[model samples]
Target: MGTGLRDRRHGRKDGGGADGRNDGSIDARDLLTDEELGLIRMEEIPGKLEEIKRALEEKVGLGVSFDLVFRVMEFGTKRTAFFYANGFAKDTVLTDIIVRLTHLDREQLVPDTLSSLLNKYVSHIQVETEDDFDKAVQFALMGSTVLFVENSGAALVIDSKSFPVRSIEEPDLERVVRGSRDGFVETLMTNVTLVRRRIRDPRLKLEIMRVGKRTKTDVCIGYISDIADPRLVESLRDKISKVNIDGIPLGDKQLEEAIISKGWNPYPSVRYSERPDVVSSHMLEGHVIVFADTSPSVMILPTTFFHLVQHVEEYRQAPFVGSYLRWVRFLGIMTSLFLLPLWFLLVQNPELKPAGLEFLGPQKQGELPLLIQFLLVEVGVDLMRMAAVHTPSPLSIAMGLVAAILVGDIAVKTGLFINEVIMYMAIAAVGMFATPSYELGLANRLVRMALLILVAAFKIPGLVLGVTVWLVALSVTRSYNTPYMWPFIPFHAKALFSILVRRPILANKFRPSITNPIDKTRQPVE
Candidate 1:
């Protein structure tokens, strides 16, 4: 494949130095096979209209796939080949473009036919010329109509991408009582529009670039030009451009994993948000957002432990109410992480219980050990969670009832679990469910399990060691150069105070120091 590509380049009269450019020494390009080389499509557009037509049919599966539509229409004396994806191309838009093109006379199709067509005839809001054949193919696959003019090196790409989109409804995970009901849709353009609509400022930059060799997924990086740190934006862009992958089937999730280099760390380095309002708020705070095509969720980078714990619901109410809610959430998160292990420790070492808190120790110790009982319940809860997801919507309530009433009652009756164990575990499970970020909740669950094992093996010291390790790891971990435990490990008193207490919107005059934003303040404060 390398040799073939080189031969094509060498054969082209326009290709300079492809013939005599270090022919002796074996280059690294020689090692790659056809599949390994990301560029499978022809790099240079074939000069002749017939060759371009043939290439489109052969390479892009024009005739093979029902959706990939190809047609040769006469524009004056010259013939033009049209490549468009059927479902993606808007029928009305493409028809209007073609109808407008049919008006060109034979005399009009003279020198610079492609230019004349683009400037005078093909009327569209978004259109561009593509010199690279592979890129042109990608454009066509993305639902744009590519016009291959006879003997022209560049193809006239008409942006007529009209993807099938779901109605903009509130996302299931990030729903709030008082907020915009419309959340981000799967469409990249629509998602950008949603964000853009909220922030009408010209400094709100949304730079798009395609990633994935096979999928060629569209990725949009959004940030306020004046507010966002240029260094951070550039760093993130470089990392994303360097992502070497065949496809991003899982969209933002896969892209996040690829760029972040998160090996075994269960904790999320970046925050994911489906709510546009939430995203806009983050952008204003000088955080950069990554929007991936075919994904409803977008990634907010330079995230911290507190970022994952936060929710839009807190801000929906009064400032004091929001602060109260924030503290409650903080408590819930801590409860999820420590409740199980602390309960286990107390039951294991009854002497550790305080004088008045004698009831904290389990009065009922069944045949099973406390550790085994906790582990069983943990696994059982996970199983039930998975089952709930797969189960039909109508049956989910019934399934939950069966698990809570039937399973729990039976297990307790059969001595598989003690009453105190079930009660404590239930409280811990509720706390886990209260977490805002799903990824963070899951990560906390892993930490909870680790803590449980540690407590079981080494008691008090094990729990301490587990927590210390978690904190130390977070202290060391960086998300796009921003510390994972920012404002806490480094101890930023002002920032930490603001995070702890959700201040009024106008009160938050300054942006987060973690992002190193160019503009420090949102508004002037007297």
Candidate 2:
């Protein structure tokens, strides 16, 4: 129940005055209590070892090997000694320790002697002072074995840490044909190693922060110390320190809850991606990255609206292709939001239609209001979408096509809703899926309904007014204090080329202005 040690200087590698007691000289007895001492398995060491072996069975439980050995040395001979580890073959690093233990003087043995040998010989030994059973179990679970010696007050703990894990592989979610294929794994240490390999500068700091009350999930904050804004980094740390949750299964939800001020809004406040290249690019630009253990995705904060529309693969590909895709995406987004509702308003409200397109309307006659007819179509589309996502892929596609085409044809033929209105609604419903992020697509769908209502009430004037308000909101929002509508509304002519259409890596001379990194330029020397 006691608070864990909080002196920030304790974990430092330097021989500083604050951590003078951390010279591996402190007695193990001084740190442990009698209750904790009881958990030490001196008498039951053999039995417990058997229990562990029985549990692990035929698996690669190589670390669970514990056996009794006799040591004979020049000073004296010991009757019994404990050897616990899985992979200590004749060629193993600990094999020499087994051979040397045979000659040690039994009468001269002290708790400190065993502890000193461990600190000197073992690769990663940690001594726990807490006597709680749960705490001891946790330490063992992490691949460390605790040794209890008979007629001794202090227990000797050795770091026989070994566990089989998958090698680093390319991330599945975020893929680029041209970039590095390496991806992060569930292990915190492995993830850190991956980042360190990319950015070797000492200034690239990785500060560890643990979230979740019980999950104790390790979260690392990565940022360039010299390039990053000091205030932003500190603020990010403060927010992370405050998160109190039972569990955080995924890093995105936990970080979103912690840092986002307007999470309730449909728009994303933080940018998330699984690519290390994208993350590295963000860190170079003064943005802080929040990486959660066990999650492949990393969160970069104060993200602007424009960042959502972008993909890292664009820069890696050809410029003309990137520009075409960007324009197509833009057109698709506009159509998704306004196409159906605007069509309904133009076709139904005779006062709002422009000169040319007015003649294409009303193949079917209906007494129902235009709003009512459009609403029915919208509801049907939503049901189809839900069914599609829940059902098998092939079946879902068939069902969606059948429901949209056959059902609409039947409804129009029966004069249940206007034929022109149903066609317009179908066009808009299909267009809404153009946004890459599923959540973003859903947000636009919801917003489209609001736009439709406005158009229904005031016709074209209402649609214009609603769109203006939406643009104003986007312009005001900040991504890590940078303008959300960067290079567009503010008009960065030189930088605007990359936003509207991505250019080659060499063509980009300036780092993204939105990142606000300490170093603004990112072009290689010719």
Candidate 3:
């Protein structure tokens, strides 16, 4: 909460001002609370070993003990202690560190000597001193080992944070036939390393920071230093750093909401990918990536509507095949959005129907109005979807059977829904499932229902007005200042073509201009 670093001088009371001056009087408006202030102050180590022990016992619940590992080591006449979380710190690494520390000779062990021990003993690659006890405690909680010497004011922090994580496997959501099976895991370091493995260039930077006051959750911002726009990176960093929250338990989803701030907007502003290759591709195109700890999915920032609709499978196929696949997907997405509504419109105005298309309307109208039937079926479909999600894997097939046979047959036979409504709704649901982005699919579903209601109530004019409003909303929507409906709304021929048809890798010689990448040329001409 404090804006700047805490002064490390001895007995400088008045909570050393943010400007590093000993103001001698604590300001009432300082952001840090009294507890945080007390914990951060380490001008002097507690006079007795019992005092330090008592503080640790009270604050971190060391006495009551769960995962906290506390050990005191004696080297000749001097005594030192090490603290770390059991599950977070690797046993082998912690044992190696402790074994190395125990070998320290009496001559090397001087009273109140922190720097000498750090240089001579600690063999770990990541070791640093923390003047603040609060920060040291935080590091310990995050799985880093904290070393406390008998009389030293500073605590040595060893980075040994390893979390329980699943092995990298192909992401279920973004599966590809010919791509790498290695996907991101829940571990932050592992996820970052996955992206690093793909983009080996030194210019690719992954800046790490912590959010959440209590959780201190790690968040990484990745970008290509040469290609990515500096302003965009800095702006994203600024927005993330300013997030004031207790925790982000849902990880990327929560962070997305905090940053984009698009209230009540159904469309997703950022694209999410669990596949390292996909994230790598986006970063090369100058998009900034956000990786949150405990989340397998990383967010690709400043995304357009086209980005959400795209799938990794397209690139895996031949250019012509990919383009064909892309167009098919686009058709599916459009059908998901408009099929039901258009059918309703045609049914409402049978005069507009073509000569052979009279079979589109229901044979026998149900007891409920056509609009009511459509709404009820929509709600029923959503309920079935939710039920499927909650159902156990073993029972899922049985659940599907119940939904397909029992629900549909009973509804149609009882005159609650017509056969035409069931058939069309099922087709629409198939299209929705075909959509690449689940969030976008849901948004489309909502839009479809809205369009259906409008057409049912106010007829043809309502359908036109609703579509116009939808387009206007998308046109006005911005993702980190990048136009949401780029290429389509702004009329970029090349980009729009790229969206409509998957171009060969050799043909994509330039990065997207919308990102304002510093190096525009992805590849030089032969």
lDDT of each residue in 320-369, candidate 2, tens digit only:
88788777777777788888767767665777677876676676568777
Off by over 4 Å in 3: 1-43, 111-113
lDDT of 1 at 517: 83
Whole-model lDDT for model 2 versus the true structure?
0.60
- Return the TM-score for each candidate structure: 0.88, 0.71, 0.91
Q: Pick the candidate with the highest lDDT.
A: 1
Query: In model 1, what lDDT does residue 120 have?
Result: 79
| lDDT, candidate 1, 24-81, per-residue tens | 1111122223343464555889888778878877887767888887788888878788
Candidate 3, after superposition: displacement of residue 14 in Å?
Answer: 33
Q: Which residue runs of candidate 2 sit more than 4 Å off their true CA positions?
A: 1-113, 120-197, 365-369, 376-386, 392-431, 489-491, 524-526
**Worst ten-residue run, lDDT, model 3?**
22-31
Model 3 RMSD in Å is 6.8
Pairs of residues clashing in candidate 3: none
Whole-model Cα lDDT per candidate?
A: 0.81, 0.60, 0.81
lDDT of 3 by residue, 1-526 (tens): 3333332111113322221232211111222333455665554445455677788898889968888877777765677788888888877887887787777777776654688777878787667776676667777887788888776777788877778998889998888879789999898778877777778775666655567877767777778778989899889877887888998988999999888789999999999899999999999999999999899999998899999999999999999999998998989999888988899999889999988887777788898998898888889999999998899999999999998889899988998889999888888988898899988999999999999989988989999999999999999999999999998988899999999989989899899988999999999566
Arranged by lDDT with the best first, the candidates are 1, 3, 2
Q: lDDT of candidate 1?
A: 0.81
Residue-level error in angstroms, candidate 2, position 287: 2.0
